[model samples]
Structure formats: structure tokens, C-alpha cells
Target: MNYDIFNGDADGIISLLQLRLANPVESKLVTGVKRDIGLLGKLTEKVGLSKTDKITVLDISMEKNQTGLVKVLDAGVDVFYADHHRAGEIPTSKHLDAHIDLDADTCTALIIDKLLDGQFHYWAITAAYGDNLIAKGDKLSNLAGLSVELSEQLKELGTLINYNGYGAIVEDLHFHPAVLYTALLKYASPFDVIADNSSPFYRLQNAYQEDMASALAIKPDHQSDKLSIFELPNEPWARRISGVYGNQLANQNPKSAHAVLTENRDGTYTVSLRAPLSNKQGAGDICSQFETGGGRAAAAGINALSKEQIGDFIKAVEAFY
Candidate 1:
């Protein structure tokens, strides 16, 4: 059996989408909420795992899944990994084909785009937008001769898909990531999704507007020249909107870093950190200072940050910028 293990976010979904579109495949999908990077472990426990199995991992960090990766490779399963996150040390196994580019301007889909020689460049551009690579997406759109209106449509589609991945779990989301990915797979182009009012694109677009409206109404919990932080109450809406809210804030003030903290059930906070757009560096490093924190340079996150560490997290961001 072939297993498609990917991050639940837009980049992860689109990376796999491009691959499957180019070379159709039937594989079991493994994914979860955007923060659920510890996915390979789930596959390791599969009962029928054997040498004939193949695995393709996208967007999630190789560093975070090292143990499961080693276990699977040792079991003789061939694995292909593509990501733009902070990969600590890639495993040197013949069974592993790892494509890791930690460039702030790139995402997993873009790496696959290059690998496929841009066979599905439009979908790659949408993933870039969803990953919050605005300038990169805009540049690519121009290179593709996309009208401003068309680019905006792709941007909104990407943002909506990205926003849908933010919930604490699948139930908090409007559609499970796997379901959403399956629905989207039928469309060869993002424009088709936008044109079909019955598509998930419209459903997510409507939901995104409502949640973003609520987020925009709230003021920052802490604001400084270098950093801005917002603390959200423990609610499903808060969880769904946190990550995309951080991206919106970063775009609003490109010079200041942004952090959106959603209160968790266990009296902790789930942090979505975005580095200053002008200086897209140090986000992953600053978040890495805390436990349960990891991501790419431009954007990173903490799954659960205790109240006591909030001040320190702020100070670290301020110091870095």
C-alpha cells in the first residue's frame, strides 16, 4: 500500500495534489490539524506495514518525524519527503528520498513545482499564497501573466484553504483536511474551484470572512515597534482563526512581528508566530526556544505555551527583531 502523509495546511495538500495530478495514485491519506506534525508515528503502528509499502511525506518537518522515519526505512519501506521547514539532520538511508529546502521564500509545493518543472505552476502559486509567501506569489503571478484580478482570486482561495487548517482538531474545522483534499483533487485548476459555488472553496471562503471579521475587531494584547501579540479566548472560532490572523497582521505591518495566541483547554496558549515580512528570519529559531515549538523561518508555532512563558516568548521575539 502507498501512504500519503502530509501536513494539513495548504502547502502540504497542494504538494500532494500536484504529485498525484501528474502521476495518478491510490493511497491512504494521513493528516491532521496544521500543528499535528507528528504524523509518521501513526503510520508506524499500522498492522500490515511491509517492504512493499511506499510513503510520501510533505510539508511536515523531517526532524519532528525522525524516529518514525528511521523505523519505517529500517522496515524497508521506500519514503519520499519534501518540505521547507527546519530539518535538523536528514536520515542517510537508501530508502529515503528527501527534498528539503529551508528557504524563507519557498514552500513544499514550490519545491515539488521545480521537481515537476512547473507542470502545475498555477497550483504551486496558490500554495505559495496560502503559505503566506505574498511577494513570491505576486512575482510568480506576474511571471505567469496573471491579471491582478486573477491573482487576487488565487490569493483568496489559498488563504481560505490555509485558514481551514488552523483548528485544534479536525472537528473544529468545517471539513477534515483529508476530505477537503479529496474534494479539491477533482479540480485541475484553482479557477475551477472558484467558479463552482458548490465547491469547498466557497464554503471555506464564507467561513473565513466571518472568522476574520471577528479577529480584526479585537485589539492587540501587547504592541511594540518590533512585535505585536494578540490573545484569544478558548473557543473553536479562536482556534480556527489564529494562524491566518497572524498572517493578516504581518501583512498589515510588515516591519513588526506578529503572534496570535489562542487559549487552549489546558490553560495554555497555542501560538502562531510570523516574523516581520521585511526580515523573514528567526521565527523558527525563536519558537524553537520553547518546548513544543517548531516551523520554518518565516513562520513557526508553539502547540502549548504556559502562561509563565508568554512574557519570555514576547521578549525573545522583540530581541530577535
Candidate 2:
């Protein structure tokens, strides 16, 4: 059996899209909402334990999935892993093929683009945009000789795909990540998805606009020179828009860090933290201070944060920036 596990967001989906497009494969797709990154352990729970099974992991943090990865390797399964998040300690195993780059400017799709020799460069660029690496995406677009209008089109497409991924669970999402990935796999280029009005791109675009409008109406709960925090009520729309809204806030004020927190059912909060665009560092470190927080430096998130710890999170962001 072959399993493909990836993050549901733009970077993860597009990374796998580029790889499968370059090297066709029949595999079991494993994914969930954008926050669901601990995936390898789920694969290990599968019924069969076979040394011949192959697995490909993308976008999720190796540090978080280390236990499952080690277990899989010990079982003699062959694995290919690629990501840009913090990797605690890469295991020494011939069964593992890991490609990890923690540079804030690069995303997993771009890393795959290098591996595939840019066979799917446009899709990779779209992922970069969706991943909030706006400047990097623009640089790659210019190198590819894309017109400004075409670049904007890809940006919107990427943003919409990314917006679809931000939900508390698959039920909260506009479309399950696996279904979205399968729909996108039909198109070799991201532009093709834009041209096809019937594609998931259109559905997500409409949904994103509605959700974003609701988010835009809400003012920041806390604003400071170094950080701005917005709190949203516990609603599906809030859950769906939190992450992308954090990106929009960061883009609006390049010098100020931004946090979008949505109330969870347990009276806790789901937090999406974006480092200042001008200084893309320490986001992961700040979030990692929390029990349920971990991600890349440019953008990190906490699955659940207590209402009491809200002040501490803000203080940490302020002290760092």
C-alpha cells in the first residue's frame, strides 16, 4: 500500500499535487483540516503492517510527528518526507528520505518544484502565494515571465484554496482537503483551475468572500505598536476565516505582528499567529511556548489556547517583536 499524507492547506495540497503530477502514483490520501498536522501516527494505526508499503509525508512538522515517523521507520516502511517547519531531530534511517528547509521564504511546494525541476512551477508559485510567502511568490512569478494580471489571477486562486483549508474540522471546511486535492489534480496548471468556472476554485472564492466580509467587520480587540489581536466568536464562519484573516492583517501592516483568535466550544481559543512581514522570525518560538502551539517561523498556530493564557500570548508577542 502507498499512503500520501499532507497538510490540507495550500502548501501541503500543492506540494503533493506537484509530486503526484510529476510522478504518477496510486495511493491512499490522508489529510484533514489545516490544523490537523499530526498525521503519521494515524497511518501507523492502519490494519496492515507491511515492510513493502510506501509513504510520502508533506508540510507537517517533523518535530510533532517524530514518534510516528520513528515507528514507521522501525517497521521497515519506506518514507519520503518534505517540509519547511522545525524538525527536532531527523532520524538516521535508510528507509527515510527527508527534505526539510526551515528558511522563512521557502515553502514545501517550492521545495518540490526544485526537485521536479519546475515541471509544475506555476502550481508551486500559487502555493507560495497561498502560504503567505507573497514576496517570494512575486519574485518567482517575475522569473517565470508571468504578466502582472496573470500573477494576480494565480494569487487569488492560491488565496482561495488556502482559505478553504482554515477550519476547526473537515465539517467546518467548504470542502474536505482530500476532495479539493483530487479536484485540483485534474488540472496540470493552477491557471487551468482559474479558467474552469466549474472548478472548486469558484466555490471556494464565493465562500471565502462571504466569510472574509464577516471577519472584516470585526475590529481588533487589542492593538499595539508591535502586535494586534482580533477575537472572533465561536461560529463556523469565524473558524473558517481565522487563518487567512491573519495573513490579510499581516499584509496590511508589515511591521506589526498579528493574531487571529477564534473562540472554541470549550471557551478556549484557536490562535493563528503571523510574524511581522518585515521581520519574519520567532513566530514558531513564541507559539511553541504554549502547550498546543507549533508551526513555521513566518506563521504558527495553537490548536487550543486557554482564555486565561490570552494575556501571556499577547505579552510574548509584544516582548519578542
Candidate 3:
């Protein structure tokens, strides 16, 4: 059997979309909420693997899934892995094909775009937008000769799709990432998804507006010249909008680092950290200092940050840039 394991966010979902659209496949889908990066482990825990099984893993950090990956490879399962996150040490195995690029500007979908020679270029561009590589998305769209209006449409679609991926759990999301992927597979191009009024694009748009409105109503928990911090309550909407809200804040205040912290049920905070748009270099480094943190230079996140360390996190960001 073929198993498709991917991150539930826009980058991972759209990366697999481009590949499947180019080369149709029958595979068991494996995905979860946006923060559920330990996907290979879930697959191993849920079902036994076989020597004949083939797996495609996307977006999630290889280092996080290293143990599960080794197990699959030892069982003779062929794996195709692609991502932009930190990969500690890549395994050397004929059964594994890994395409990993740590460039801050690149994403998995864009990596697949180059591999497929841009067979699904528009989708890749949309994924770039969804991943918040805004400038890169616009540049690619222009190079593709897309009209400004069409490019805007792609951006909105990407943003909405990305928004749907957030949530403490899949149940909090309007559509599970696997279901969203299935729904999107029917459309040959992203434009078609936008053209279809019944597509998840429309549903996500409505849901996104509601969540963003609630988030916007909350005042920043802490604010200063160097950084700003917003603490969201432990609600489904808060979890759904934390990452996107952080992005919005960073864009609104280009010179200031921003952190959006969502209260978890356990009293810890799920933090989304964005370095100043004017200086997008230290976010990942700053976040990596925390035990539960790791991400790219432009944007990073901490899975669970202690309430006490909140002050320290703010100071670290301020000191970095």
C-alpha cells in the first residue's frame, strides 16, 4: 500500500496536491491539525507497515520524525521526504529519497514545483502565499505573468486554506486537512477552486473572518517599541487564529517583532513568533532557545511555553533585533 503522510498546513497539503495532480496516486492519507508534526509516529502507532509499502512525507521536520522514519526504513518501506525545516542528520538509505532545503524563502510546495518543472506552478505559488511567503508569492505570480487581480485572488485563496489548517485539534477546523486535500484534488487548478462557490475556499473565508474578528478585538497583552505580545484565551477560535494573527501583527508593524500566545487547556501557551518584517532573521533562533520551539528564520513557534518564561521570551526577541 502507498501511504501519504504530510503536515496539515498549507505548505504540506499543497505540496502533496501538486505532486498528486501531476501524477495521480492511490494512497492512504495521513495528516492532522497544523501543529501535529509528529505524523510518522502516528502512522506507526496506528497501523503496521510492510516491506511493500511506499510512503511520501512532506513539510514536517525530519528530525522530529527521525525515530519513526528509521523504523519504516528498517522495515523496507521506501520513503520520499521533502521539507524546509531543520533536519538533524539525513539517513543514508537507497529506500529513502530526501529533498530538503533550509532556505528561509523556500517551502515544500515550491520545492516540488521545481521538481515537476512547474506542472502545477499556480498551485505552488498559492502554497507559497499560504505559507506567508508573501513577497516570494507575489514575485512568482508576476514572473508567471499573472494579472494583479488574479494574483490577489490566489493570495486570498491561499490565506483561507492556510487559516483552515489552524486549530488545537482537527475537530476545531472547518475541514480536516485530509478532507480539504480530497476536495481540492477535483480542481485541476487553484483558480477552479476559487471559481467554485461551494468549494472549501468559500467556507474557510467565512470562518476566517469570524475568528480574525474575535482576535482583533483583543488588546495586546504587552507592547513595546521592540516587540508586542498578544495572549489569546483558551478557546477554539483562539487556537485557530493564533499563527495567522501573529502574521497580521508582524505585517501591520513591520519594524516590531510580534508574538501571539494562545492559552492551552493545560495553562501553557502555544506561541507563534515572528521576527520584524524589516529584519526577519532571528525568530527561529530565538524560538529555538525554548525546549518546545523550532522554525524558520522568518517565523517560528513554541508548542508549549511556560507562563513564567513569557517575560524571558519577549526579552529574547527584543535583544535579538
lDDT by residue (1-321, candidate 1, tens digit) is 899999999999999999999999999999999999999987787655899999999999988999899999998999999999988889889999999999999999999999999999999999999999999999999999999999999999989899999988899999899999999999999999999989998789888889988888888899999999999989899999999999999999999999999999999999999999999999999999999999989999999999999999988999889
lDDT of 1: 0.93
- Which pairs clash in model 1? none
lDDT of 2 by residue, 1-321 (tens): 889999999999999999999888899999999999989988787646589899999999999999999999999999999999999999999999999999999999999999999999999999999999999989999999999999998899889888889888889998899999999999999999988989998888888999999999999999999999999999999999999999999999999999999999999999999999999999999999999999999999998999899999999999999
Give per-residue CA lDDT, model 3, range 262-302, as digits (tens). 99989999999988888878787898899999888888999
Lowest summed lDDT window (length 10), candidate 2? 41-50
Candidate 3, superposed: residue stretches over 4 Å from native: none
Model 1 misplacement above 4 A: none
Query: How far off is residue 270 in model 2, in Å?
Result: 0.2
lDDT of 3 at 105: 87
lDDT values, one for every candidate = 0.93, 0.94, 0.91
RMSD of each candidate?
0.8, 0.7, 1.1
Which stretches of candidate 2 lie above 4 Å from their native place? none
